[model samples]
Target: MKIKKILNNSAVVVKDRDGEKIVMGEGIGFQKRKNDPVNQAKIDKVFVMKDPSEHQKFEEILQLLPEEHIQVAEEIITYAEKEFGVMINEHIHVAFSDHLSFAIERLTNGISIKNALLDQIKILYVKEFEIGLWAKELIKEKLGVEIPEDEVGNIAMHMHTARMNAGNMQETIDITTTIQEITSIIENSLKINIVEDTMSYERLIIHLRFSVKSLLSNEKNHDYDEKMVNMIKENYKEAFACAQEVGHFFEEKYRIKYPEAELMYISMHIQRFYGRVIMS
Candidate 1:
C-alpha cells in the first residue's frame, strides 16, 4: 500500500489493489508524502470504507479528534469484534469515535449527561454493557479520564447497534426506549411489577426487542385466526388490553402500523408475566 494522502502524524489514506483505505499506526504518516510506501510493520489499523461519504467523514474525524481518543475507540471496536466473534458494522468506527471524543471533551469541561436508561441497558444488553464497562476501563487507562457509568451505557448502546447492524445510534435508542415503554405499559395495565433478572422479565424484553425490530423493518408476523385472537382477547382480558396499549404506543410513536400477531404474542407474554408475578 502507498500513501494517497496523509491524515495526521499517525494516519494516512492509502491505495492498494483492493481499493482506498485509511491506515493508522504510530508515526506512520509522519514526514511522509503522497505515494510513499507504507511501512507494513507500522500499520496498526486499516479501515476499508466502501461508502465515499463515510470514508470522507472518517478522514475529517481523524484530522480533528485527538489521535489518542481515536486510538482508544479503535481498541474498543477491535475488542468488541473479537469478543462477539464477528465483524461489526464499519460505521461504529466513525460513530463511536465521534461519540467517545465528544464524551471526553464534555467530561474535561465538567459537563455530564446521565443515561436515563442505564439500568435498562444493563439488564437488556448484558454482553454489550459488559463490553462497555471494559471500554470504560480502557479509556481510563489510556486517556486518564474517568467516565461515568451512564457513559458506559451510552457506549453499550453503540455496541448493540453496531453488532446488530441496526441502522444508527438513534435507532438503537428508539428500540431500547420502545422496550422500556412496553414494559411500563405491561406493568401499569396488568397492575404488577415485573422484577428484573426473572425468567418472565427476560423473556418479555427479548420478545419486545424482536417485536420492535420487526415493526421497524416492516416485517410481517404470523397472524392468528380471528377466532384464536378472540379467544386470547377473551381469556386474558387484562393482558390483551396491555398489549393493545403497547400496540397503540408503537403506532403513535413510530408511525408504523402495529401487527396484530405481535399484539397477541405480547398479550401471551404479559399473561405469563402476570401469572409469574402473582405466584411469586
Candidate 2:
C-alpha cells in the first residue's frame, strides 16, 4: 500500500482497501511521501477505525505519543485480544494509548489517580481485571515504569469500556455501579457470592445492563409470553420476590416502571443464579 502521509520515521497514514489506516514500524515511513509504497518488512502494525470521527481522534492522539510507548501499548492490546478472544474495537488503540500516556505522566510526576470502581471491577469483570493485571505487567516490562497498583484497575476499565462501548467514562462507571447494585441485591437475597465467571452470571449481567439502560433512557420493556411468565412467578416465588425488590429499587431511583413480564424474566434470571450457587 502507498503512504498517504508520514507521521514520523516509524509511522505513516496509508490509504488501503479498508479506507485510511495508520501504519507503524521501526522505519516504515522514513523518507516516505504521499503515494510512496509502504514497506511490508518494516511494518509493525496498522490501526483503523470505522468511525471517521474516531479515526481522526486516533491520528491526533497517535501523534502525541512516543513511538516506543505506542509500540508497547500495541503489544499489550494484541495480548489482550488473544487472551480474551474478543475483537476489541480499533478505538481502543487510540483511547487506551491516550490513557496510558496520561497515566504514565501522572506516575512520573509522583501523582496517582485512583479508580473508584476498582473493587467493583474486580468482582464484576474478573476476566477483564485479570487481563488488566497482565497489561500492567507488560507496561512495566516494556516501559520500565512501575505504576501504582490502582493503575491496573484503570487498565481494566479500558478493556471494559472497549467491550461495552458505553458512554463517556463517567457514564461507563455509572453503568458498572448500577449493574453491581442489581447483582448485590440478588446476591444478598440469595446470600451467596456470585460466580461472575459463569455463563449464567454473564447472562444476568447482560440482561441487567439492558434493563438499567432502558430505565435511564425512559424506554419501555415489551411484554413477553404471559403464560411462561405466570408459570415462572408461581413456581419461583422466592426468586420473584427478590426480583420485585430489585424492580422497586430501580423504580425508586430512576422512576422506571417495570412490567410484569420484565419482572418475571428478572426473577427467572435470578432463579438461575440462585440455582447455580446452590448446585456449586
Candidate 3:
C-alpha cells in the first residue's frame, strides 16, 4: 500500500486496492512521506472510515493522542467486541478514542470528574461495567494511568452505547439520568427507601429501562386492560400517583406521553417497593 498522508510517526493513511485506509502500528510512518510504500510487517491494524465526518474527526483526534494511547484504546475496544461476541458500532472507534484521550489528560492533571450515575450504571449495565473495569486495568498496565471508577463508569457507558448501536453519547447519558430521576421519583413519592441489591430494586430498574426504550421508540403497548388499569388507579392510589409523577417527568423531559400500560406496570412495581425497608 502507498502512503497518502502521515497522521503521525505511528499512523498513516494508505491507498490500497480497496480504498483509503488508516494504517496504525509502532513506527509505521517513521521517516515516511506521501507515496511511500507501507511495510506490511509493521502494520498492526487497518481501519476503513466510512462516514466522512467521522473519518475526519478520527484523524484529527489521533493526531492529538500518543501512539500508545491509541493502541491501548483500540485494545479495549477489541476486548469489548470479543467479550460481547459481536462487532460493535464503528462509531466507538472515534468516541472511545476521544473519551479516553480526554479522560487520561484530566486524570494526569489530578482533575477527576465524578460520574453521578455510576451506581445506576453498575446495576443497569452489569456486563458493560465489567468491560469498563477491564479497560481500567489495561489502561493502567499499558499507559501507567490510574483512572477512577467514575471514569470507568463513563467508559462503560460508551461500551453500552456501542453495543446497543446508540451512537450518540448524550443519548446514553440522558437515558441513565432519566433512570436515576425515575428511581428518585418513585422513592420520594412512595416515602420509602428502596433497598439496593434487592430483587424489587432490580425489577424496578429493568421496568424503567424498558419504559424509557418504549417511549423513545414511540412503541405503543396496546395490550392494556382498561378495566384492570382503572382498578389499579383506584385501589393503589398512592402507587398510581407516583407512576403519574413519573409520566409527568417523562413528558416534560422527552415530550412523549408515557403510555397507560407502562403506568400500570410502574405502579405495580412501586407498590412492591412501598412499605419496604432496608434489610440489614
Question: Quick one: best TM-score, which candidate?
Answer: 3
In terms of lDDT, the best-performing candidate is 1
Q: How much is the lDDT of residue 114 in candidate 2?
A: 69
TM-score for candidate 1: 0.86
Weakest 10 consecutive residues of candidate 3 by summed lDDT: 271-280
lDDT of 2: 0.79
* Candidate 1 lDDT tens digits, 23-129: 99999999999999999999998888878889999999999999999999999999999999999988888889999999999999999998877767887789999
Error of 3 at 223 (Å): 1.4
For model 2, the stretches where C-alpha displacement exceeds 4 angstroms are 16-18, 164-171, 179-249, 258-280
* Model 1: per-residue Cα lDDT at residue 233: 88
Model 3 stretches with alpha carbons more than 4 Å out? 278-280
TM-score quality measure for candidate 2: 0.68
Give the whole-model CA lDDT for all candidates, comma-separated.
Answer: 0.88, 0.79, 0.87
Q: Write the per-residue lDDT of candidate 3 for residues 185-260, one digit (tens) a residue.
A: 8878767888778888888888788779767977877488899999999988988999999999999988988888
Residue by residue across 118-189, what tens digits does model 2's lDDT show? 656776567778888887788888888897668888887788777635455566678778788888898888
| Model 3 steric clash pairs | none
Candidate 1 — number of clashing residue pairs? 0
